[model samples]
Target: MQNLQSFASAMSRRLLREAGNLPALSGNDFASSKEIQRPLDVLSQGSGSFSAFPKSNEQITTPSLPESAENVNAANQLSAPVTQSADKESSGSKYSNWIFVLIFPAAILLILVPILVCRKRGNASMGPWRTGLSGQLQKAFVTGVPKLNRPELEAACEDFSNILNTFPTCTVFKGTLSSGVEICVVSTSISSIKDWPRSAETLFRKKIDTLSRVNHKNFVNLIGYCIENQPFMRMMVFEYAPNGTLSDHLHVKVYEHLDWAARMRIIMGMAYCLQYMHHELDPPVAVNDMRSDAIFLTDDYAAKIADVGVWKELADKAKATKEDGSSRSVSPPDLAGNVFCFGALLIEIISGKLPETNDPDCICIWAEEHLKAKSYSTLVDTSLQDHQADELEAICEVIQGCTDPDPMQRPQMRDVTSKLKAILAITPEGAGPRLSPLWWAELELLSMKSN
Candidate 1:
């Protein structure tokens, strides 16, 4: 009985030892499963996070477990690790896709917005621009037409001259005639008239009447005349020229004041006026005495032709005598002679010298001699020494063409206008010669000449 009791006690001790070993092994297996699952979670985070783990650590050992519980636990642990890793990877992918979707469209819009704005601005800036003669003339006329009286006419002329002093432009003032009748007045400084014949007075009135019907920037506006019964006392009020006359200003000293630009402008203005008279008018007005003295200056220094009526009267008187079979006065030449005189004027403009007098030996003859020799430099105004050689040559050629000895060979006023306008079109703005103080000085000079 004593042996049986001792054996039972030994068996009890062995069972307790076995149970203790089983618990230790189960704990080790649980720790091993956790380590394995942790590795899977680390890989699922992202490449950056996974790289942070220590690669040098040794792997831990796991103890064996009972068959049924170990198999079930292992399967669950493995499945949970894989499922968690997949979920983490899908979430990372969704975040990356969301960032891409938000950034790409914003980048495209940033690039395209400035291009659209630039295009819109470009279209807005390119609106209409105006540069036409008819439009400018109409504007000038409208502004000047309303104020036409004796005092208002003089004021207009003075105002026009003042305006020209500020900028290059022309203006006209009309004088009150019969009640509401207003006649145009253009002012300029030209050669003085020593005597006013009865024929001249009649012609002046007739020409004024004719000119009143026309409107142009280049033609003289015949406002009204002040008739004095005494000789050299009559005053014909027209537009005032702030810049004076071409004749007085064309000399070397005076010419320097008129830059090449201003001179060209004067030529262009005169040519256009003549063109209007010869071609544009209904019964083509003939400028029988076209001398530089007859060409007036506007406030802007543009040429406004004067003395249209004086020659018309002379022509009419000559015609009347020829019809009546009476002895004619020592008359001037006909229309052909007028063209010849105009040619002389053109030569004077280029050479900056007075036309040859009735004396056969004149400046025109001298210029003609030099012109035939192709010594064009001698023909140009010495004040224009710095101007373009090519331009000077072209102008000389035109002058020579206009001043041809034969009237038939000379270019008509229309052709003259066209050529001058072409030259102006090509010339750079402000490229002409500077205006001279001599232009203004001429007012005193005219007063002196009158005395």
Candidate 2:
């Protein structure tokens, strides 16, 4: 009994010393110490007094107790690292979140800054029109319509002071390129167009696109275009026609009078052009200004139409429509209007008189009456000689059909082309040798074949 008490006292003192050295105790440790004290106090009270140590040792004991302070200390040591590991994991997750938040925006800035730098550089090189004329127009200028440098064009056209002819909408300037090829530069003042300050690029792009697609021998060749700033200008470059316009030859007498064969060829070419524009092209093109003045003559008197698909009138019409709030979109060019004008052109060609000089409405009427009376001479140009009567009658018949007031009553250009071809076949060449002897010989052979 004495040995047991001594052993208990020594064990209790050692446990108390260790508990005092501990840095701090958790709530669980404090509660566990209290639980040990209840049993120890019960024993101490029951035994009438054991030795009291410090306050920490007072709460716990070892030797006589089955649940010892030493065992609780061992369990606390095992559990301490696990709680610290959970705290470390939580701190690591927070640190990773901060890194991600910082890195994402930095990555975005790295991507965006270079693009902005490149865009600034590009704007510096290409000028103000670069952004306005990007995408399809930029691609078109590169691949389809050659973009002539404005400075080079200015030098060629003598700073555009060498004017060839002036019209209400545009001015023509004759220039010889550096390569010694003669070119006609047509300049239209876009400054006059409504809302041009805002829509200059779009208007020019649309106009140039319309002009560029006309690929035919009978239409003036679109060589290139120029757009410049600081006294801004928009110009189209064309192959210069040495013989000038049909109006120059026929009305103004700038050149010698056209012979019967030449007139026939011009008529035939104009017919074919109408056919090509009105039927052959996917979306049929309409000529806004279909006058004799619009026709150019090559060195060989081959008729090539100028300003075939370009007009400021379209923009004006669109502006008018917009002002009235009548339409959000521009209406398509009136193909029937061209048909009516073509009839007037045919009348002008035959009579050698301006339809505008006579009653424009009555011009078709009188020409039709002359055709009906078989008075072909009255309808024929006084300048034209040796033209076949059948050819005149046939052409006047086409004019009558074209000039019908009702648009639906007018014949398609395809049909007009066919009729003109039939007339051309029957009519013999006058004043010039036949165009192709072999072709003519074949025609003669075919004529001999059937009724």
Candidate 3:
């Protein structure tokens, strides 16, 4: 019994020792084993078409994904040079484009600048000669006027020492050339610059151009321009009218009252000038600055239009506002405005009064009323008591037509000239000494020429 009990105790001790020696796995261990095996299962069950990586590098066959990755990496490597070459080509093209853009405008400027300079040089002419003031004297010799040397002009104007008239924009000096020819020097008040008031230089050039083209006995001729550098003076020169402006004759008591024939002669001369300007010239010059101040008489009493279109240039500065409230450069007055201005002058010539300053009773209005009433005798100047009534009425009708408010209705300068010429033939000899001695001599000369 004791032996049997000892055997059972030994068996129990052995079972306990075996059980303690073995490591026991919980539910977590079982889960980890299944999770690890699942990925291996998926790899082993991949499509049969792809073979696994081979042992020998020479026979290394890649599966589908690895082969695609290798091909993509190879494509990137091969395309690098092509992309770099395209970038280089694009960069070169851009550089060429930049160079072209930079050079084109500079090329245009280089071409255009010289052409403009040559055109300017071409305009330089001296009476029957092509002379240019490119290097030293910047004088614009217009028409066939003689190119007065700077030294000669300096001598004439006494180096701008004397001021005949001090005006707003320029100072006028009476000058005499070495050859005894008289000239008036007009100098700007501003110092030497490209332009004054921005548009002044342009207007001055325009004036020069107008004067250059005009060639009439009744239009003041441009002598030349004196543009000096050191003692900078921009000047325009014109032949001196010793008798002064027409304003002097009509307004000043020092001058003798113009007789009826003399007055008619003045009006006729003005019409001749207008015809020359508006009809004769290829591009007709619109002489709007038609005031007594613009008219100058020669020693022989021939009236010449001076300072043509200058005052208009000065007054043209302000921009004109459109009806729609937009601003634009004010253009020169149309031909109608010019006609109206000439009509104002007619009032002065007929009435022997300064028509410009007559405020409340504008002589034009008074003349219009008189004409409507057939008051022809009243239109004649009171100074000339001895005049033919029939001839005077005819003259009044001409004045009325010229001074018409509607420019379209007014007779053209050519028509006006024809009418005045007819009047001259019918005009009877005046009772008194009709004209200045010089003018009578000129008339006789003209008659001789006609014969």
Candidate 4:
């Protein structure tokens, strides 16, 4: 019985030592360790009903069986609390580890998702042609304007080997379709195309739609367009003008100097086209480009307006979008700007001066100075002498009104066309201006010379 008490006391002492040496996991664990240690101290001291340990020479007393059983029961009750506390501590540690494991990946996913989405969107915008034609070009297919492919364009342009003219923003290639019709292919280089903003593709499609709808004798006809992505090509095809640009006739002197009558006819053609655009169309299409080079001449010296179709691309090259690629605020139609450009073109035509040269002999400054002094003689082109004084005065008056300092004060294109018709002595019901009798004789002479 005494041996049993000593064994229980030694086991309690070992458990107390282990508990003291262990590190506490938390405040609750430390409190649990303290509560368990109190019972362990009572058992190790043998304070319940037995002496702690029997000495070698000291006498030992053996208790009754009931007393020994009671002592065993006390030891068991003390051990139960320690086992329960240990189980709780182990479970708590496992739960905390699980929480840490789950939270880390969730945080990483939150950070990565936005970055991936933004990258995908950027790539999609850069290659919008991957989705094929959507709004405008889809409807254009059934509207007489064909949607051409890269291979057909390549064959027509002779593998794009025939280059006609190269402008800063695009290249003009001369091509002949399978039907043996001549067409001009305007294409942008791949290097410069990379710099185009996201809105450039959208704007290009819209311009194609609008130009396809246009049907005017004085406007260049849009035949079809080609869109591709592998080599990144966007091209617009138009009817080839054989007589070349008005600038070529006037400034380059490749042909005979235009007489006063030829100039009037060219100006009248442009006016009629401008009137149609400004008054006839529902949402008026402005002549955004009015340079002399932009005007193509027919074999008969009639004017055909070109470059209006690709004005948006030309504008993008001049000015880029916002830094983040967002489009700028929408501006109202540029009808007033069109009126101003027409006035400048008129001055250029009359003075036979190139505004782009910006020389000391600039026509705009020269005309303004001469008109303020009412000096009509100096404003006429040096080559022109056959024009009557009254006719010259009427034309100068029109120029003055069109070039008014305030845009609001300028005459509408419709009014300008009416005044031009009146000056030509043609009624609205008349088919066209009566050809000058001398004009026919001169035409026959030129034809004979060419032959």
Candidate 5:
């Protein structure tokens, strides 16, 4: 009995010391005195008088009482399992807390990252792209682009009365409405594709959107559009350009000679139109096809741009490369490409011949050859009587800047507009270069010799 009491007293003291020394788990340690006492107290229940301990056998102590010994033995048996279970629970809680602290934030981040990325991509693809132009236009398709009723448009078109021009993708018709409004109708040809009517509707809808937003006297207005069944035709209506294309006047010689001042006026007007479309509109419009054929002339020699449409690159399975030597998935050229097209236009205006007369590469070279030699007279058309070297050079500067190979070096549309405006301000209407005092003196000398 003395030995058992001595053993219990020593073991309890050892357990208290050891509890203080158990290392931290996941940077959190159990407090020593309070925690140690809790488990030890539970373990020592019914083990009476732990404060008192019997000495060694030399003290001549009598045997311990039966009741006390039984209680001590029972408590000793229970203490081991209780202490073990408590230690296991403490270790398990620490491990669970450590795992949550490490993993919870990472799990949240993994979930949020993909969501943010998907939202950004979705907005870019589906929403209207913001532009540098005026903020009035948000979406490309605004409320003004209407979807006309099929029957009413057919009735107005006089049931496809006259064919104006035919094309592979669409057909043009000269339609005279009961209201006496003459409209040019371009109807899509949906015969070749699997389900092109649906796709063509998408195409025409975009066209309607493009035309509706364009507001200018120089631009051919889109009056209305028709999407009809029975024939399944999707057509857009534009106000007729009265005098036909500028190609007829310059190339075909249908009209009388256009003077230098008139030609410059036409060119300046065209530049202003381009500036409005490129800089003033939100999400700028780029017209890929700019040529003499694409410009229209009115009775008073007013120039209006025609056949304006967006060019998009699409993948073609049948052809390895396009006729223009571009990619299969064809998209519109950037702003610099548009500027290059303007350069080509300027070359046509100055030379009074088509860019196609020479090789596409040689066109710029031809201009450079003429300009560098100071042979300015050759730049003017045989039809034009007025010619000025200084004026032509000033106009040529803008053209040269636009056609530069490095896109970054090219002048912006706004800059081009400003430059042309300055030229117009200095130039007189209905006039040629003023005669100098040197020319008058030479004329006097010639008159004296004749006398």
Candidate 6:
């Protein structure tokens, strides 16, 4: 019984040893298996749950889902940062684009308004004088007397009185002043007259009387005068020159048909008139307004000095004088300076061109330069080409003398008139008609007299 019991104990101890060896083998198999980590397993077991190993072909062949999941998570983390950066860059670009669209057109409108307003105001101020033909006719009709004869002057005064009764608007008259006698009349409206201050009116009337007494053929004939008691108006009576102003013949675009003989006659007459005013008339009248428009022409083409009384009148008005007296407003040297203005007038008459303030080639300056260069041929009016060369040269010389810039160098009006007469006396009579091409071609069909 003791031997059998010892055998059972030995068997039990072998079984126990075998069981321990099998458990160690299973542990080795487990260690050889491919390792993979799950996110949850990692969190539960900590970083120590994963083991580092050299990969064999068998381990590489195993499904790598857990490793793929780890790679996918890493890739997603990196892509998220890239997308966030891209979104910020896109947002920054959009904001920059939005700011540029708002600021460019507002700057242009603020700069153009004032320039338009000034131009509008300037145009408006010139409206009265620049009004059309009807307005100009109204102004002319209301300002001066129409041409009349001595018998007609008498009839006109009677008619004027009758007209005044019918039209009270016609209150002023343009008529003759005969040795302090005021008679003969052509009437104008009191309201139609341009406003002149009371001081100006009294002064002008006195000077007009002085001018009216001067008797010369070339001087405008003032027969009589009167001033009615209206606030800003005055009237004068004078012999009217029927042929209109010298400027009409000199520069009229459609009606400029003065022949060479007529022009020469007119120029001579003008020279004589200027001479008489400057040398013969007592107190040496200075023609301050020497424009061609102030020169009147008779039916015989004789030049009569109109508005000779205007300068003295203006001077008196400026001085606030009322008494009828001859006052020398301009000095002798200044009166001589009027010769320069006369030269400009001559240029306007000779050439049909007006003096422009802007042109460097103004008529007087051009003529003087040409004269200095001995190119007198250039001074002849292009329309006067048919005129005798010697006569033209003489006229040019006279014009140059009159227009001299230095007042001291200008010839006296008496000398100018004497020279003009000599030239006229020598000029052949009845020269063939020389006409302005601009007027001649159009008016050829009409049988009007060349003069």
* Candidate 3 structure quality by residue, lDDT tens digits, 1-451: 4554575466546554554444434446445644453221111211122222222464533233223454457656665665566567656755765677778789999999998886666554322122211222223343333334466567667877968877655678887654455667777765655333435545556666666666555666565665565665567777566777777887788986677776677777777777767876666777756788788887766677776446345424312111233334436536655656666776777677766562413777878888888887777777766776766777677767877767688877777667767866522222111332322222322232234
lDDT of 5 at 259: 72
lDDT of each: 0.49, 0.63, 0.59, 0.63, 0.57, 0.50
> Cα miss at 334, model 4 (Å)?
1.0
TM-score of 1: 0.45
> What TM-score, to 2 decimals, does candidate 2 have?
0.59
Best by TM-score: 4
Question: What tens-digit string does per-residue lDDT give for candidate 6 at 1-451?
Answer: 3554575466545554554343222343333334633232111111121112223663412123235565568656765665566567656755654554444344444455565675455443322213111111111112211212344344445544433222332343333322222332433343323434455554455455445434455555444344544433344555555566777776676655777777777676666666666776555666656667767666566676765435344534544433543344433424676666666766666665656652323778766777788676666567765666777677778878887767788988878767877777722122211211212211221111121
Candidate closer to the true structure by lDDT (higher is better), 4 or 6: 4
Query: Per-residue CA lDDT of candidate 4, range 139-192, in tens?
Result: 233332456778777887899999998866778898875555567788875345
Candidate 2 residue lDDT tens string, 132-157 = 22222222343234566677677778
Q: Report the number of clashing residue pairs per model.
A: 19, 0, 1, 0, 3, 10
lDDT of 1 by residue, 1-451 (tens): 3554575466546554554443333345556764564322112222321211223364323334435575557656875766577667667855766677778789999989997886555333211101111111121121211112334434434433432221111133433322333334443221134333444445545554454434455655533343334222233444344445676677535443667766677666666656666666555566655667567665566676775445435445534644664434434324445445555665677667665564322666777777788887777776565565676666667767766777788777677656766656533223222342222222322332234
Stretches of candidate 2 exceeding 4 Å from the true structure: 1-139, 190-201, 308-311, 314-328, 357-362, 426-451
After superposition, which runs of candidate 3 have C-alpha atoms over 4 Å from their true positions?
Answer: 1-151, 192-198, 229-232, 308-333, 356-361, 426-451
Order of models, best lDDT first: 2, 4, 3, 5, 6, 1
Residue-level lDDT tens digits of model 5 in 1-451: 4554576678657655655454334221234432443232232212232312233563422233224454457656776786566567656755765687679889999999998997665444333212111222222333233345555555655776677766555677776554454556666655434333233344456556665666544555454565556555556666666566766777776566667777777777677767777886666766656677767766566667765443121112112232343333325437777777777677778778766642334577778777667676677778776766666877788878888878899988889878887776522222221221222222322232234
> Candidate 5: minimum summed lDDT over ten consecutive residues — where?
311-320
Per-candidate TM-score against the hidden true structure: 0.45, 0.59, 0.58, 0.60, 0.56, 0.48
Backbone clash pairs in model 5 (N, Cα, C under 3 Å; residues 3+ apart or in different chains), count: 3
Give RMSD (Å) of candidate 3 vs. truth.
29.4
